[model samples]
Target: MTQLQKQRILVVDDEQAMRELLTDLFEDAGYEVSTAADSFSMNRALEEKPCALVILDLRLKGEDGLMLARELRKDSSIPIMMLTGKGDETDRILGLELAADDYLMKPFNNRELLARVRAMLRRTTELSLPQIRKEDSYSHQRYSFDHWVLDLTSRELFGPDGAVESLTYAEFGLLEVFVQSPNRALSRDQLLELSRGIEADVFDRTIDVLILRLRRKIEPNPKQPRYIRTERGLGYIFTAAVTQC
Candidate 1:
């Protein structure tokens, strides 16, 4: 019998000992592990093969891992677990603020690290699954709202002029939650759970950022959003009528 292929994980740290440690640790747990010492090598590894998650060190030789995390967010929704040193709470907070999936301090227990990795991988898989429509028989499905159409299958958005507007994975996930729960005021906590499936580490700013990005694409006037509206002290709500077909 052929052995099952393992999910690939990229570990980026400038320390050779830490890199070797994680490579051995994850590989022992049946993961195909890869290591990079810095952003350049990390990018090259990502370009060469798909990685399910990245374990990055907050302090690199000359590069800021936080900035690298931000760049990764712009292009991919791959789960990121930041590794921080002692007394680095400020950078940890900034990492969460920048929308990292989770974080772990240096000298973390191997058991806890393994658990977090499994949990994050599960959430990533959940978010990547295509939502099931009521009528599964329909092949090309779309959700229409306020002159904008979201193709559920392709996960693409179309403007009133019928031009396709590109959407990142995070933007699409948050929009899917809002559209499905139209006219309901969803709090940051609720949005986190509904959108990402991992709520413990989620921050309010992350949800706010996703909402702003979605409004730019779906709202006629993003400055005065007609679709997604803020509820002051409450949260946000989708006001337009959403029709799925």
Candidate 2:
């Protein structure tokens, strides 16, 4: 019988105690775990191997986890879950805005933490799988809208002039949902459910933050979005006509 390899998770924290705690926690939960105390080591670990998810401490001794998350999101779609001792709403929102997939405060329940980690990994795996288009009986890899092309296979967004715009995993997922359901007002909850799934422990603001990020990438003027428009009380709608290719 072939045994499946365990999924790997990287835990980044400045405190040795916290790192060891998480290492033990995840190892007990049947995941292959690695620990890093700083950004340098974290980057090196990721470079040397692939990780299914990252658990980052928001407050590091000499590093900023939010900045690290931003840098990570620039190139990789690896899911990130942030931990903070502080319960400041602003910091939480800022972390989400920078593309951190999940956030948890200190004194978190071990069970809840594990559950969230599982949810994130499951969502990542689901998104990576090829989807069969029911309408055409063939998979469509690219979606074109308003002179922009979103290639699902490549996970790249190409601008009108042929330049490529960088999109975080969350950004790409939200954009995918919008392009697929064009002209419909999707509530924040619906958007979150469609993009991340029903099991995601995300707030409504997370969707709003992702929408803002997508507008910045795809809108001619994010201030006055032409494609993703807001509905007074309903939610948001993608006004562009999308064509699958």
Candidate 3:
């Protein structure tokens, strides 16, 4: 297949051997692969070619992966899979909070890695198809809630002040789910099923983290969320009226 026709994936890791291994693995699986040892190289590659997803290491030579992940999410909704050695619970939760779509431990199996890459790419494609159709069918593709506007095509959030807010892929997915079902209490399990497909390994806490991130963007006060209110033992509900344009 032509390079341009293949799905491209970027691997950001400082380890040379690991880079080669990942490149070989992805290429063997019929994907175009690019490697970057640091943020600078990663940025250069991203600027040069569109990437389907990024496999970022948690630790770089002189940089932190979490920080880089946050920086990437601030502007793009590209799926990120964090690679970490420590496997600490805090790091896992924090990575998810930063909108890393998924993660793998250092000693990850190659098959598992392949499975994750395929799953993430599939979900990304599924999420994008609706936006494309909406853009073509509607004059203005936006979802409004509580004076805030979310551009469905651009995946952009605009506040009442007309300022843009950055939302990670997961955060946006959760928000979309809520907006489509406002006033109904959705449990974490239901949310996990709806937003992340049928991925059973997805934790319930991840839904909570995604909710917190979404509230920070849509709620007038994240501390006292008027739109997304917790239902105590049940879960959370989007109480605000949503209008689609």
Candidate 4:
């Protein structure tokens, strides 16, 4: 049997030991690994390498990891797992709100870290596949879901007061997929296939991050997302009915 190919992982930390340790661990487990000490190095590596998952440290000297994650979320659907010493629940929540797919506290078990990394990579792979649909076959009606209106023609996501909010290409793709298949459960695998373009190497849990971004822009209460409903293990569903334009 051909061994399954390993995905590349980027480890960003100011601490040299942590970066080296994670690099060794991931490499030992069959993954290609890269390390970055700060945002500048991270950007340089990102440009030179292709990573399916990023294990990031939230605290950095210049440009915090959270800010970096936000910037990354703006362009790519790269899965992010934040590593930090922060033990506060509030910090974890904030990390999630900022689009970190998972949070790992400092001094976490190595085995547990590997497990979470594997799980995150797997989930992202399932969400990054390309999905097919008839060209121009999809249509959406402008309607109120939470505070935003869906404009199919403009392909724009609007805020509650009809204001335009910044949405990255990945986020727009996710929203279109959900709106096109409203009330239907879209599995992570399905989403991954549909969302990742032919040449894109990024994974799908980026889908979840994009969804969170969309909800933050539209939903009055992101915790209780009115439009994009989590379907537990199945993935997600646009619970709010859409009227086709």
lDDT of each: 0.80, 0.86, 0.84, 0.73
TM-score of 3: 0.85
| lDDT-based ranking | 2, 3, 1, 4
Check candidate 2 and list the clashing pairs.
none
TM-score of each: 0.75, 0.86, 0.85, 0.60
Question: Candidate 2 overall Cα lDDT vs. reference?
Answer: 0.86
Write the number of the candidate with greater lDDT, choosing between 1 and 3.
Answer: 3
For each of the candidates, the C-alpha root-mean-square deviation to the true structure, in angstroms, is 4.1, 3.4, 2.8, 8.6
Better of 1 and 2 by lDDT: 2
Superposed Cα deviation of residue 29, candidate 3 (Å)? 1.9
lDDT of 3: 0.84
Which prediction has the highest lDDT against the true structure?
A: 2
Model 4 C-alpha lDDT per residue in residues 1-245, reported as the tens digit of each score = 12356688999999999989998998889898889999888899999978998888988766677888988877776878888897776667677667666677898888878876776676565444322221343543454454566664544567767676665445656777777788899987787666544333234445666677778776779999888889888998988766654
Clash numbers, per candidate: 0, 0, 0, 12
Top-TM-score candidate index: 2
lDDT of 3 by residue, 105-203 (tens): 889889878987888887677656675656464654688987888776666678899997766666767777888899999999988877776743566
TM-score, model 4 to reference: 0.60
